[model samples]
Target: MFRNRQEAGRRLAAALASFRKERPVILALPRGGVPVASEVADSLGAPLDLVLVRKIGVPGQPEFAMGAVAEGAPLVTLRNEPVVHALGIADSDFEAVRDRELIEIERRRRAYLGDRPRVDVAGRVAILVDDGIATGMTMRAAGRATALQRPSRVVVAAPVASSEIAADLRREFDKVVCLEECDDLFAIGVHYADFSQVGDEDVRRILSHHATVAG
Candidate 1:
């Protein structure tokens, strides 16, 4: 078990030291991953950026992700065709959910990053960090979005993840760096002693700190 995201991030960063030579960029899945990624960025002295991908949840079941939207000049979206077909989800319904998520993504981008341009991952190693992986849907979507940017290598880094999902991530990503693997990851907070809620203000502050440090 980890004491908190900070400690987890530091340990994860140590494991990722080999990638420092690659001059990698740290990409965080915001709201929860910001703090963790911030530590990694500090350790590597790399540019910190947000992935800005929101899950397109199923209608009336907001927790169930049918797809996800990632912000970019041209937005990157990936849908689970099997899930949509199995659930008989209408295209209109899916689009509506995606649009709503896009709005949220824009809000977060403004709130946390402001006018700072997104770090280009093209031909660079891109490491995607999150607090932990539960269902792996969001992270998988994030990987797909990062792939569209043509990164030389795409790596998913986290403190803990389900053993099964960790294996799946290995196949999808160029590399997967997780500190701990558990059979049951229903609640990631269980692995941390202090997994407090990471508010919008916290994200804003972390991003600002990284920007200042970078400058």
Candidate 2:
């Protein structure tokens, strides 16, 4: 298990050493991904930015992600078809959750990033980093959003992910770089010793720090 998110990011950065030559732009899925992506951006001397994806969870069961919505030029969304069908979630209900998440995505974008310009990924590799992958919904949405910007290649990096999810992500991203593979990732927190909630302040702090370092 990772001692903490920072340690996990350091390990993940080491694994991603080869990407340094490509001059990748790191996009993190905040607020949990900020710390992890910071190490990578620092290691590779790359520009860091946020993807701003919010999970659309099931009604009443908020921990269970039904899908995710990501902020983009025209916005991007992904739904868990099996979960929606199995749970018999109606279109109206799904729309309600999606709309609510879109608002939060905007709020986070304003809060953490403010008027800062987005890093251009058009001709460079874009590395999307998250603390870990559980349902893969958020990461997929983030990938889709990144794709819209016409990156030369899209890469997803995480500290740990289920073996099945890692393999499945290959179809969505050009490269998948996960430090640890597990047969069953019961929860992303299970792999971290200090998996505390990442607060808004933490997100803002990391972004500010990265901007200073980049400048």
The per-prediction CA RMSD against the true structure, in angstroms, equals 1.7, 1.1
Which residue pairs in candidate 2 have backbone atoms (N, alpha carbon, C) closer than 3 angstroms, thus clashing? none
Q: Encode model 2's per-residue lDDT on 175-204: one tens digit a residue.
A: 999999899888999899999999999988
How high is each candidate's TM-score? 0.92, 0.97
User: On residues 62-160, what C-alpha lDDT tens digit does candidate 1 reach at each position?
Assistant: 888798888765777888788899999999999999999999988987888788877889999999999998778788888888888999999999999
Worst 10 residues of 1 by lDDT: 206-215
lDDT of each: 0.90, 0.90
lDDT of 1: 0.90
